[model samples]
Target: THARAHLPAAGAAAMDVAESPDLQAQLAAAVHALNHASHPSARLAANQWLLGLQRSPHAWALAVSLLASADHPSPSADLLFFAAQMLRRKIQSPDYSLPDNAAQLLDALLVAARRFCLAPPRLLTQICLALAALALRAEGGVDGLFARMPHLPDPALLELLTVLPEEVAQDESGDTGVDSATRCRFARELLMHAPAVLEFLLAQSEKPAAADGVPLHERNHRILRCLLSWVRAGCFSGAPASALAAHPLLTFAFNSLQAFFSFEVAIEVMTELVSQYQELPQAFLSKMPYIREVLLLPALANRSEKIIAGLTSLMCEVGQAAPGLVAEGSNEALSLSDALLRCVAFSSEDWEIAESTLQFWCSLAHCILGIDEQTSKRNATQELFLPVFSSLLDALLFRAQIIDIDEHCTGRVSSIPDGLVQFRLNLEELLVDICLLLGAPAYINKVCLFC
Candidate 1:
C-alpha cells in the first residue's frame, strides 16, 4: 500500500503527486541510469531527475531512512554517497522541517553507522557530512543564536563558544528557526550514541591499507572532523568530550604510524583535544593513559621528528592545562620527567623538540623560582624538582658535552656555524636556572655529578 501510494502514474501528470516510496524508487532508478545509461541525453535526463527529487520532501526521508538502516539495499558506495548528499540537500531546503520521528531517525543513523563498520571512506564521509548538517539544523537553524544566543547567560555562551568556532557562532542563515525546546536535541542525540559513532571513525582509520591510491586515512580524518564539530557545538559538555579525549582505540589509531596517513590524522585529533582539556576535571584527566603511549610510540620515540614535534607541543599544552598530568602510568611525574629528558638528549632532527623541551624545563623552573623581572617573589617548586631536575641536568650536561655531533643533527639547533661555544653557554644558562630551583650545589652534586 505504501509503495502503491508512492508510485507515479505512467503519464507525467501524476509525477508531482507521487508518494515518498515511489519517488525514492524513481530517484534510485535515476541514479542507476545516470551511472549506466549509454546515451548522453539519457544520462542528462537522469541527472536532472535526480536533482529534482533532491528538493522534494521524499528525498530527505528516503535518504535518511536508508542511512538509518543496517541493511543497505544497494552495495554501491556511490549509492550511499548519493543518499548522503541528498539528505544534506533536503535538510538545507528552506521549506523543510524536522520529520515526525527525527529522534528515531537519528538513532537509526547512528545504528547504521555502527553497522556499516567497514563502509568505505567515501560513504562514511558523506554520512558524516549529512549528520553534521543535521547537527546544525538541530541547533535551531544554526543562525537563531545571533537573535537570541548572545543574550543568554555568560556561562552558557562561553561554553558554547568553547566547542564551536567563532565563524559558526556568528554565521547568518535565513532558514526558519527550530523550536527552542528542540534547539539542542540533535547534539544531545549524538551524545547518547557517541561511543558507536566515535568507535566507527577510529576503526576506519585502523583498517588495513589497500593498494588503491586513495588515502583512506584522509576519509577517517574528515569523519573525525565532523565528530569534533559536533563536540565543539558544546552540547554534551563534560563527560562525552572527555571520554573521547581518553578513548584507548583513538590512542591506538594515532599511534599506528605504519599507516602514516592515519598516524597524521590521529596526531591532529590529539592536538585539537587540548582545547577541551581546560574543562575536564582533575579526576577525569588521569584516565588519559593514551598520552604516555603516544609519547613512547616506537615509530615516534626519537625517529620521526615531525611526528614527535606534534606530540611534544600537545604535551606542553597539556601541562599548561593540567598542572601535573603528562602521560599514563602510576608515576606520572617521573614518567613525564624521563620522557622530556629523553626527548631532549636524543630529541628530533630539528630544534623543535629541543627548544620545546628547553621551554618546558623553563616552564617547570618558573613554577618554583617564579623570579622573572615580572615579580620578585618566588615560591619553592615542591618535591617534583628532585626527580625532574635530576633527569633534566643529566640531559643538559649530556647535551653540553656532546657538542657539534648533536648540534648538526637538529637543523634548528643554532644559527651560527660551529657555534658549539654559544650552545654551551645557552645550556649553562638553563642549568643555572635549574640549580637555582634545586639549589646550585645540591643540583650539581645530585644530578650534574652523575651526568
Candidate 2:
C-alpha cells in the first residue's frame, strides 16, 4: 500500500504509469544514486535525473532527499544552493500543494540557513534568497506561513545580514556585489518581513561592536546597503520604513558624506540617495543643506580621479534637481554653483568628466536663460549665470576640428573623420544651444569662434 499511495494521479492522462511499483522504485534509485555515487560523473548524472523529475508530482519528494544530502559534514555549496532553489521553485508552482510535513520541511531549511553564513558570497546569497521565498510566500498566505512554529524572522534574517560576505563593503572600489536588479528583488522580499528586519538594523546601529575587528563605519556601510536596497526597489513604505526615516540615532547616513579619509561608504550612500531623489523630490530636496555640505567637502580636492568624477557628477545632479540651491545670493550666501564650476574647470582635460560637469552647467544655463520655460524668465543675474556660460564656451573649444586626420591618413585609421565629426557635433550642438539660450550676441560669437 506504501507503493500504491505514491502512485501518479489516477487522472494523469496519457503518462499515468500503468504500474505504481515501477515508478516508486525509480524514485528510490534516483535518491540513492544521488547520495552514494562515488564518481563525479555519476553524481552529475544523478543530479540531472533528479532535476528531470521536476515536472512530476514527486518533485517535492525528490527535493526533500536532495536537501537532506546538503547536510553532509563536507557540504557542496553548489549542491546545497541548487537543492534549496529547487525546493523554493517547487513550492512556487500553482498546482503543487504543501504536504502534511510542511513544518518539518521548513525546519530543515532553517537549519541549513543557520550554517550558510560561513559559505561564499554566491552560495550564501542564493540560500538567503531561497528562504526569503518561503517566508514571503503566496502573497496573502504570508500570515499563515509566519504563524508556523520556529524562530522569529528578526534574529534569523539579521544573522544572514550581519555576516554580509565582506564583498559588499568594496562597492565603491569597483566590486559589483550582485546584479542590482536581483539584489533589489531579494531586498523587497526581505522588507516584506518589515518591522522585524528594521528593528535588527536599528539595534545594530545603536550599539555597534568592533566584533571580528570590522570597523564601525564599515558595519554601518553594509547595513546601509541593506537599507538602501529597499529604497532603490521602492519598498520604502510601511511602519518599519517610516521608523527608519524617524530614527535619530541613524542620522549618520545623511551626515557621513563629509567624513575625511574614513567615509567612502557614507559618501557613496548619500550620493545614491541624491541620485535617486527623483523618487520623492520633496523629501530628498529638503535636505539640500546637508547635500551641499557633502558637495563642498575639502577632502574631495585630494581624492583619486574616480572619486573626483563621481562626486562632481553627483553634486551637479543635486544642482540640476534644485537649481535654486546653487543660484548665487538666492540661498543668501554660499551656493553649490561654485563647487560645480570648480569641478568642470579642473576636469577640462577628460572629455567624459568634462561632459558630465558641463551637462549640469547647461541645465542651469537653460534655467537661467529661459530657453524652454513656457512662463516668464527666471530672476537670474549675470553673476549667477556667468560661470555656466563660460564653462559651456570652454566645452565648445574641444569641438574645433584641428586637422581632419581622415584626409591625410594613408594606412590604418583611428576614429574615422565621420566618427570624429559626430563626436564634435555633440559638443558643437551643446555650445550652439547654450549660446542660443544666451541670445543672438553669444550665438554670433560662437559662429565666429568655429570659423
Candidate 3:
C-alpha cells in the first residue's frame, strides 16, 4: 500500500538513480526486493516502475534480471504478457538505447516466452519481433545491422510472417491504439533487417512443398509479394541501393523473378525492381518473349490513364537499362505498342488519356531509336520505326489544335480540352534527341512544330 501511495515519487526517484554511478548496486537491490515481495502485483508494479525510468545500465539490467530468472516457476500468463508488453514499450521508446547486455537479455526473454507459452500467437510473435528490432538497431547502420543478424533461421523467419497478419490487424479500428504503434514498430524493425528477411523468404519459396495441399507456385507468389512490399517501402524511403543490394534477400528476390516468369507479377515487380536497382538482369531481358500478351498488353491500352502512366514509367526504366529488350523482334513490346495506339486512336471520352497514350507512344519511339545503334548489324530498320513515329506525330497535332481552340473560347472550355500539353513537351524533347541520332533535319522541322 505504501509502495502504491508513493508510486509516482518512486518512479521519479528510480529515473534519477538510473543515471547515477551507483546504478548497478541500486538496481541489484531493487531486483532483490522485487523477487522477495510477497505480492505478485507489487512485483509487476516494480517491474513497470523500473521500465518507466529512462534507459540506463541499471534499469536495463534489472529488467533483464526480472525477465531472465529461470529458477522461478513461470509467472501467471497475464503477468507474463504484461511484462512482455512493458519490455517491448521500453525497447521501442525512441529515447532508449540498448546496453551492452542486450543480446543476453534477448536470450533470456526468448527462454521465458517459450516456457510461459503466451497465447493468441501474436503476443509471442511481438516479443520475437521486438528482440529482432533491438538487435538490428543496436548495430547502428544498414550494413552493420545485417552483420549482426546474418543467416536467420528459416523457422524464425517463417514465424515472423505467420504472426504478421495478426500483428498488423490487432487494431482494426484504426484508432490511436497501443497495438497500432506496436505493429508499426515491428514492421520498421523487420525492414531494418530486410536483407536476411528477404533471403529467407526466397529460400523458402525454392523448397518443394510439404504433403499438405498448398501448392509451391502459390506459396512462392505470396512470399514474393510480401518481400516486394518491403523493397518498395525501402526504396520509397530513399534507402541506398548499395545497402539494399548487399542483402542476399534482394539477390533471391531478383532470382525468383528471373525464374518464375509470370507476366502479371513481372509487370509490377519489374517496374519497382528497375526503379530501385537502376538495372535489369541480362537474363530477364533475354527472356522477354516468354511474357504473355493477353495479360499485359491489353491493359496498357486501356482508357485508365493512371495504369497507362505506370506502365509507361516501367517501360522507360526497362528501356534505360536494356534498350533492345523492347525492340521490334520482341513481340511483347510490339504488341503492347500496337494495343496502346489502338486505345488512343479509338477512345471517345477524353483527350488526357489520349495525350498520355501519345506520350507513351513517343517514349516507345525513343526507346526503339535508342536501341538502333546496338542492333545496327541485325538490320532492324528505320522502316520499322517510321510507322510508330508517324502515328505519334498525328496524335500530337490533333492534341495541339484542341488546346488552341480551348484557349480562344470565351466561355468554359470543354472538360477534356487540350490534355496533351505535357505530352507535347515530352514529345518535343524526344524528337530533338531522335533527330540528333538520325543526323538529319528532314523530320525535325515537322515534329518541332508540335513541340
Model number with the top lDDT = 1
Candidate 2 regions off by >4 Å?
Answer: 1-50, 53-72, 91-104, 139-141, 144-196, 210-218, 233-250, 255-303, 328-335, 345-352, 357-359, 371-382, 399-413, 416-433, 443-451
lDDT of each: 0.52, 0.52, 0.49
TM-scores of all candidate predictions against the true structure: 0.45, 0.62, 0.47
What CA RMSD would candidate 2 show?
9.4
- Clashing pairs in model 2, backbone N/Cα/C closer than 3 A: none
Please give the lDDT score at residue 211 for candidate 3: 21
Error of 3 at 45 (Å): 22
Q: Write the per-residue lDDT of candidate 1 for residues 1-451, one digit (tens) a residue.
A: 0111122211223323433456656766788889998999999999998887765555655665556544445535666678877765555454556554554444444444444535665565455444445556653433433233334332222223223332243224543333434434544544555454445445544566542233556544444554455455542356565565566654554445445555555555555565565654243235234555654465354486666665566556555555434311235554555565666766433344655666566656655564343432333234545666767777766655544455455766544434444555556567777777677678758664646
Worst lDDT run of 10 residues, candidate 2, spans: 1-10
Clash number for every model? 2, 0, 1
- Which runs in model 1 stand beyond 4 Å of their true positions? 1-76, 93-118, 128-302, 305-307, 323-335, 344-362, 371-451
Writing each residue's lDDT as its tens digit, candidate 3 over 302-412 gives 544444444444444554455455554455555554545444454443555555454444455566555546566334655565665556555555555543355556686
lDDT for position 443 in model 2: 62
> Cα deviation in Å at residue 212, candidate 1?
24
For 128-161, candidate 2 gives per-residue lDDT tens digits of 5554445433333334334432353433444444
Q: What is the C-alpha RMSD of each candidate to the true structure, in Å?
A: 12.5, 9.4, 12.9
**Residue 213 lDDT in model 1?**
35
Comparison by TM-score, 2 against 3, better one: 2
